[model samples]
Target: MRDYVDQLKEKRICSECVGEPYLQDQIEESGQEAECDYCNQTGRTFTIEDMASLVEVAFQQHYERTETQPDGFEYAMQREGIREWEREGEETIDVIGEAAQIDVQPATDVQEILADRYAERDPGAPREVEYEFEREARYTPKKHDDAEWHTKWRQFEHVLKTQTRFFSQEAADTLKEIFGSLDGLKTQAGRSVIIEVGPGTEFTAFYRARTFESDDTLQEALEAPERKLGPAPSSLSKDGRMNARGISVFYGSSDPIVALAEVRPPVGSKVLVGRFDVTRSLRLLDLSALQEVEAHGSLFDPAYVTQIKRAKFLDRLSRRITIPVMPNDEPFEYLATQAIADYLATEASPTLDGILFPSVQAGRGQSNVVLFYKAARVQAQDLPEGSRITASVASQWDDGLEPHYWVSEEVPETPKAKKADQYAHFFGWDEHNPVTQDNRDPSLKLDVQSLVVHHIAAVEFRTTPYSVDRSRIAMLTDEENRTGDVPDF
Candidate 1:
């Protein structure tokens, strides 16, 4: 039989600390040798007190690490020191046979015994509480569950990924399966029949959805409290800006060719062609319908398809530059020109030097293209003593006088005159005087006289938007005049 101290070492508690120091001393003083001749080993024989003390010490050490008692105390004790006494009918097994067999039952009822011993110990001992806690796991594949939004996003992605047209059979079937009410639309073939008013009365314009910067506008409109389903046409004005129908196109390119390629249609879609600027990110109109316009070109010709990728040497260097016209104010326009002038003064002037037929036009009127000249800077010190356009004097409108209102010199003598004020209010304009001068505000003053142009550079002319009809046509540049006449194709 192995002693309590030696047997405990074979278990996880390999340290020499075993119960009270006095109990260990008592076992050492007994001088009885515990030996197993078959295994050729000798060890001290432990008394009943020694065995109980060993269990108490082992329990506390285990609690220090885990903050709980050992899960199976009985099995632990049996493996360490305690042995079961043989019954009357049972024959003595060999040493190896006894070591091999594990009695399922514990040698002693350790739980009942340890309950009393642990209770006797001081409450505020070192091995009392566990400070470290196991953190909750983040992503466990087995714990994953799909959410409602996930399913919705997946359906949306499927449509976009497959490039499904709204009128396509697949799109119709999918929407019908999801909504149930759309099944009736299948017989309509996604087209509407229009009754003509006269000989030529028809939808002269293609009514496609206007693209917005974000979808929040549509959300707000749909959730409005007064909106109803399927109202009469008379209830809504023809030019209403309510945006009752939500339509959006997702393309960053302003080129008509690129927009057509993005839609991937069967060749008859209406296309919008216009540049995106600050006031309008997309100022396009669906005036032109797609048609089989003949392309005349030989792959070997140098002038053939000068648009970037089609060219051999220049390759991707071809570009269309868009400069937005400032509001019809002389001061602000001067400032904008200065910005462009300062840009040309830098090394990057070569890029913008290539702009051809850069002309100025009225924002809201059909006017002839004015020659946009590179202006010179004039300081206040360089002007004469008392010039009207000089910087020394301020404008007459800056006197800080409040605007005076009164009836016109000629009042309305008839029904139309009586409704003049109401008509003015309806049109959101002041009837007394439509124009007001408030130049005291610093924004109106001309801070600088001019912007200097640094150097001249080579520019390739492509097209010009004619001031007469507002139609863009192809042109070239030469020595006589920088902007040349349109080439005959």
Candidate 2:
């Protein structure tokens, strides 16, 4: 009888007896049938001894013993709060059931099994201790501290928009820290966010669009399309998503349609789109890559938790930076992004020439690129040193057909070379007009053959439509509406 009683305590528990999906699957694959001690019915199960490893792991990953607090007497003498004397953790049996999603009896049995197993190692140890299971406070597997980053970013935005725009030392320092942290962020696959653009690279060309309100404006642009279609000169530049007022930057797209969408031209307007070839190698930060940034490490590592939090924060920050802002709100809203552009272009280590971000106006997969002032300069068309040049346009059409337009540049005879004495009289004559036209660093060459003109007959908008519902309610009687009184339905 004594031997039988001892054997009953170690009876096997079937897979059906386990509640956790993973444990159930693990047991089903490896366990054999036996009479479950807790359920009292014969079923497939593992003995308590066989389940020890799994139980130990589950507790290690999800539970921590609650700390003991000072009693009321100690609190009065030590100046501790009322909470110090209050019970703090869930009951041990309740915790086991909740953590394993098991019934009360099974939880109680498991607790006894664990207690017995633990007692064997240290017979004199106390058994009155309680444990607390992690619920909402569980360590995130992805490891990003999104709340902290979000709070910091919002503070930065508020400071830039309301308190200071030009000379906020605090804001500058904060932005610098944020960017510095993002410098080496990598995707789970270990790919860097920095990308190269120029000859031989995938992103060798970009399309820019300019909308014209009238035929006259269109013709004017056709005459000097390269100059007109390129980035606006600093003086004529307006405040944009990535630039301040009077600060010029080339805003183009990998896809021409994306470029047109970005400009948001009105109906019945003409859009002149031109492709420009990147003239030299340049580095750009790829904002779209931020979505895949992740940190992978053991949950037990303290540093891994911080790493994952940063990764999650960066993923969210990418979208926040690229979200579309209405024209009316752009002045205040664009300050943060403009500041980012400035920092990446001028202050970042291994300085980037621009940023490549997803096009919010065109939806996902399509991207837009912004080249800072230094990398946005367009290379002028080469011409003879002493020759005068003129632009001409010819339009031809047959009956009931669309008119075809052609733009051509005509150059006259070159002027005779001046004598040595004549050149000596005007020293630094060549210096007066340097080789680089407009005194700007040239980085792009206009691709004349890729020029395209789009006539906008109508504008299309993609939107989510919601139905508005109206409800009517009768006024309540004074008796029924009495303060703190319940009304019968």
lDDT (tens digit, per residue) of candidate 2 on 1-489: 345434545766777777776667666777776677767777567776566445555555445555466565867956745334544557666766665666776665666656555555665656554322222112111212468767888998998988888878887787776677555778878878888999999899999999988777777777666668987876678989899988778999999999998889999887989999999998898998887887765333335555666677778888888998988999898999888888788888778899999999999889999999889978866644444434333344565545455665555476456423222112212434555224556889988778788888888888999999998876777876877465566
Candidate 2's error at 192, in angstroms?
Answer: 0.8
| lDDT at 254, model 2 | 94
Deviation from native of the Cα of residue 383 in model 2, angstroms: 2.5
lDDT of 1 at 350: 22
lDDT top scorer? 2
The lDDT, on a scale of 0 to 1, for candidate 2 is 0.73
Q: For all candidates, what are the clash counts?
A: 0, 9
- Candidate 2: worst-modelled 10 consecutive residues by lDDT: 134-143
TM-score of 2: 0.67
Candidate 1 clash pair list: none
Error of 2 at 224 (Å): 1.7
| Backbone clashes counted, model 2 | 9
lDDT (CA) per prediction = 0.25, 0.73
Cα displacement (angstroms), candidate 2, residue 391, comes to: 5.8
